[model samples]
Target: MPAAALKPKPLPTQSTAKRPVQLDLPYAPVAKRPLPAGRPREWYVTHNRRLKAMRLAIALLDSGVYVPNQARNETIRSTARRIGVHPPSDTTCHMVRALMRYTR
Candidate 1:
């Protein structure tokens, strides 16, 4: 095969980055989310409460104690405990449970 038919020519090699880079999720530009017009990169921090909150939500639904979208506060709190989520307080658990109910 002629050179033209050989493997496509490679692009000129550029300097390799010296440092390994890490990427963030749920962010738009640098991490694929919309970034500021001009400034340093911004990383969105993930909260652990949301994790347990979501876990509580899913577990309750999975256990059939709470429907995908029709659970009440008591149902969520019970499910949260069963799933090992530490509810900060009765009130907060109440709130997250109610919120989880509506979000379903």
Candidate 2:
């Protein structure tokens, strides 16, 4: 290919158009589905722990704590509290950091 053909074109400028804000369905109540019956006790524990870790990780990210280092155990616990969740255990906090690390 020719040198000019190989040259990248300049990118277009971003639009400043305002978009409609999406609102949560607070008034539309959704029923919570219970966990499946007959699962092993260990399975339930692991499942709940994973859910807690995911919630903490999402809350941390939303609050501008992207890096795992910034999400210490105390910070994770505080986020959980703010989000109306029980304070995460040490293992859950570690899992939250791991989620953040791998996702990033």
Candidate 3:
């Protein structure tokens, strides 16, 4: 039994592998929760800013804006407008870019 004679034939590759079907499911409606009580004012502000930044980052990603440099302040503000969110302040825009950068 020579080692070279024991080589196995290569397996065939599928052009399209099986993928899970995408379902167009609707989400159940849920009430928005109020912020917890007793938090400092600055804490609330920072929390809200972070939430806005996350939302902006998600919108940017869905619109094919992957790079931080591609998501300039104007672009972010424009996206905010499209998404019905108020135009983000310069600081919020910077935070959005930072989120995209670190997530990458």
Candidate that scores best on lDDT: 3
Task: Kindly list the per-residue Cα lDDT of model 2 for residues 1-104, writing each as its tens digit.
Answer: 79999989764434532554455665864798999999999999999999889988988999999999999999998889899999888989999999999997
- Pick the winner on TM-score between candidates 1 and 2: 2
Which residue window of length 10 is worst by lDDT in model 3? 11-20
Q: Model 2, stretches more than 4 Å misplaced? A: 1-31
Write down the lDDT of every candidate, Cα atoms only. Answer: 0.57, 0.89, 0.93
Between which residue pairs do clashes occur in model 1? 27-33, 28-32, 28-33, 28-34, 29-32, 29-33
Give a tens-digit lDDT track for model 3, residues 1-103: 9997899956444544366545568688689899999999999999999999999999999999999999999999999999999999999999999999999
Q: Residues 1-104, candidate 1, lDDT per residue (tens digit)?
A: 78788878564433443554444465563454553454533222224455456667667656765543455666666666777766445554555566566875
Return the clash pairs for model 3, or none. Answer: none
- As for model 1, its CA RMSD to the true structure in angstroms is 15.3
Give lDDT for model 1. 0.57
Select the stronger candidate by lDDT from 1 and 2: 2
- The TM-score between candidate 3 and the true structure equals 0.74
Q: For each candidate, how many residue pairs have backbone atoms clashing (under 3 Å)?
A: 6, 0, 0
Candidate 1: list runs displaced more than 4 Å. 1-46, 65-69, 88-104
